[model samples]
Target: MSTGAFSDTGLFVCFEGGEGGGKSTQSRLLQQWLEADGHEVVLTFEPGDTEVGKRIRQIVLSPETGELSNRTEVLLYAADKAEHVDTVVLPALRAGRVVITDRYVDSALAYQGAGRTEAVAEVEAVNRWATRDLRPHLTVVLDLAPQAGLGRFEERDRIEGESLEFHQRVREAFLAMAAADPDHYLVVDARGSIEEIHAVIRARVAAMLVTA
Candidate 1:
């Protein structure tokens, strides 16, 4: 059995993928749709939602900062997750609020772990420790080819500016994870119409609602 923990009181949904995968749009759509369905939803994102996380975001995403040690980047992300879960995610989930996050530990595992060539086990261990091993109830992977996704972004961040091979690795990592955990993951083709994608996500999430 999987050792990761989940909320008994509230749903925890996460959106993950490569760059330009429309995580923000889909997460917002889910949040709005759930709220219309009468859920108290908290929409947030990783590495930048909390105040401390904002600074970490700059360090990790800023192109001017250039190259950073892979381990340092992992630890920085871990710190943000620590603060985000402790102050934001856990409190809301405890009060029976559905939490929709644009990204989470999986992003760290895909980006820092696979993209940067860091050992996946070591990276996962750090992130699990940071978030106290809390796993999302559902992770929607917006699947898209790295080349196609990267082409959508006009301005590339530090991570986005990586070579195509790096992004290909990241894409493979996300798909591989979803394949390994079919019960908890939904792999949505990101090229579909926005409404079509949102409807698919809504249907899955609606089925998971116990009292809604």
Candidate 2:
């Protein structure tokens, strides 16, 4: 496992958690704030960032694709990440842009590892290699219970349609990963108001900016 620093001139921040945790909302908010502060920001997401990734995303998320094997699903996600980093993420980071992602490798670790009952360590290894060992400067996990989070979604995707037990495992996996790396993670309770969550996120990123 390669746990090292990312680009010195650029910041790669990833938002992670179970479904309907408001990761997209927070990622966009952070991007807007960074841009307003005169920083070049790239807002992106995994499993659908690039042209190839779009097709991969459709296959992975569509319920019609039905009953994929665990290994096959993991490979599809890894493929998306490989193409995403090569085309969208790495270039933006190289250009000294603040890359704010809605989801990253951690999603794979939590969803595939825990939800599918696979080895978490192996999942992490695959994702790390898929992303070329790129580590986010900060990973913000919007922690919420599976029942409440899933209830917020009117329509569920293939993964979201999973059993509540699966989602609970996924949530625990995310929390465990965050707990293992506190310095690199900000675990926020998602029950808070949108503005309240953004405020805490802003404070953390502000502290990083001062030191960066």
Candidate 3:
């Protein structure tokens, strides 16, 4: 399978996993580390990074919205991806800034595709087009049991409140994708100490920087 398009001007890294897998923490740490090294870095997230995406994120993540059609959810997420790429991601990357995203196309494929039991191929196609086929140079998957991850959160979003089985499927989806593309992925045991996990991620990113 194709790895999709990667930027030639800048580095693109993404963090992926089930809910509460410390994607935010790791993404922040990576951004800080990159900035400290004198690299211009842009930290962003999907479904709400742009003005238009914020509304889409509210409708998709808010419990008050109740259930939506599985296909509807995919398109909403895709719309956010479209807006985000056009308004934020592409701009930074073209400017040679490191772009670290909390989640990207993989999240939609795992959560809306596998978690919701939607057609994975269809989800991938929509997202590929949504982001203009932009792919991260490296994706860090924080491997963790769904139970452990869910317990980390006191409050739940709509997606977070999903059943254990649902999250299990999502977790599997991330692993399967990573396994298929080892060169573009790093799977981390999220149960490790925060600093340890960050060290592992930084080491991998460090190597990529030598080439970047």
What's the residue-level lDDT of 191 in candidate 3?
A: 95
| TM-score for each model | 0.97, 0.97, 0.98
Q: How big is the positional error of residue 19 in model 1, measured in Å on the Cα after superposition?
A: 0.7
Residue range 1-212, candidate 1, lDDT tens digits: 24799988888999999998899999999999989989899999987999999999999999999889999999999999999999999999999999999989999899999999999999999999999999999999999999889999899999999999999999999999999999899999999999999999999998889544
lDDT of each: 0.93, 0.92, 0.94
Candidate 1: residue pairs that collide: none
> In model 2, what is the error at residue 173, expressed in angstroms?
0.6
lDDT of 2 by residue, 156-193 (tens): 99999999999999999999989999999999999999
- Which candidate has the top score in TM-score? 3
Q: List the residue pairs that clash in candidate 3.
A: none
lDDT of 2: 0.92
The sequence of per-residue lDDT tens digits that candidate 3 reaches over residues 8-57 is 99899999999878999999999999999999999999879988999999
Ranking by lDDT: 3, 1, 2
Candidate 1 off by > 4 Å: 210-212
Stretches of model 3 off by over 4 angstroms after superposition? none
